[model samples]
Target: MGGDHTISYPILQAISGFRVVGAEECWHKSLTPLMKEVREQMGDGPVYISFDIDAIDPGFCPGTGTPEMGGLTPIQALEIVRGCRGLNIVGCDVVEVSPPYDFEGTTALQGAHLLFEMLCVLPGVQYSR
Candidate 1:
């Protein structure tokens, strides 16, 4: 539930099981509160992060298939990931990065950066670089 303004019907149907927090909702509220709700829902279980590059604004990440405007900035994205700190993150992934559409590889770099951010929030992972 990141930056999907024009979500298709099929995709909507597919994500019915997820608790979607829309882009507007994210903009209007702080991520900490939303993440608190998520934590309550998740209850003490291991978490998995599936980060879509398209969640970021095209201005920051132009390599995704469906680049949407008014999306999260890189800093905002990192903060959202950071909000997962103290959770039991067992695994994570970053997806929907199209290198062919990237400008000077900025999007790919951002994807990597996001991955790093996720790793930083994991329970016991130690990263340096």
Candidate 2:
């Protein structure tokens, strides 16, 4: 689960089009509404989530191959992943973590946590709530 931003091209080839909710959008909009757009486009179809590590600020995730100055917060990351709770998430991944760059392993840890969050949002995972 270490996808790079460039990986999107291949993924896009499989679909007709997509909506870009990059760092700029996440800064102003709620992921809930963003997820709604996804739901509207996907229409109960099987979905795959590919999260790139560099999407988060380098301060919080500097171990990635490309570190960006301003990015989503770890909390916002959870919001994004959690936003998929009701979708038919066929598969998901978090990529772009370069271990050598993050000596303390925080980036790796963020990747791991993102993976865990992805798992939690998959269909058929019953919650006690």
Candidate 3:
């Protein structure tokens, strides 16, 4: 978690005029603690959540390079994203999807579906190609 935030800090710092703080492990049992800390440190800025489905439990989404056990469910993940309502979501991406690893196509399918769900939660403003 710290590594991810460390890598993301510089880019966010460049785009926004504030320093990015807090390193929350998305797969942790309680997401609220991490989220609260981020909110406290960052203070309600536009938040773009990059969800790597691999972070979810393999049973829930068995398609990714590294599948962790006991990760959040799809619904839980979606809720986390939705919970950040009212914050500006500039953009998002769900990466690390190696289709070869997903024998049943469940992972890729869910990945695409979740992308649509995320779009729905985004600002109503239209996007151009």
Question: lDDT winner among the candidates?
Answer: 2
Can you tell me which runs of candidate 3 are displaced by over 4 Å? Answer: 1-44, 125-129
Ranking by TM-score: 2, 1, 3
Per-residue lDDT of 1-129 in model 1, one digit per residue for the tens? 333334344343333234877887777446777777777776666576778889888988999888999888787787778877877666667888887899689998998888878879888766654
lDDT of 3 by residue, 11-120 (tens): 47435444432224444355555555545655556666677787667897787888877677776666656554545667666766677888998888777876766676
Model 2 clash pairs?
Answer: 1-94, 1-95, 2-95, 2-96, 3-95
Model 1 misplacement above 4 A? 1-17, 126-129
Write down the worst ten-residue block by lDDT for model 1.
9-18
lDDT of each: 0.75, 0.79, 0.62
lDDT of 2 by residue, 72-94 (tens): 88888888888888876777778
TM-score of each: 0.77, 0.82, 0.65
Candidate topping TM-score:
2
Candidate 2 residue-wise lDDT at 91: 73
**Clash list (residue pairs), candidate 3:** none
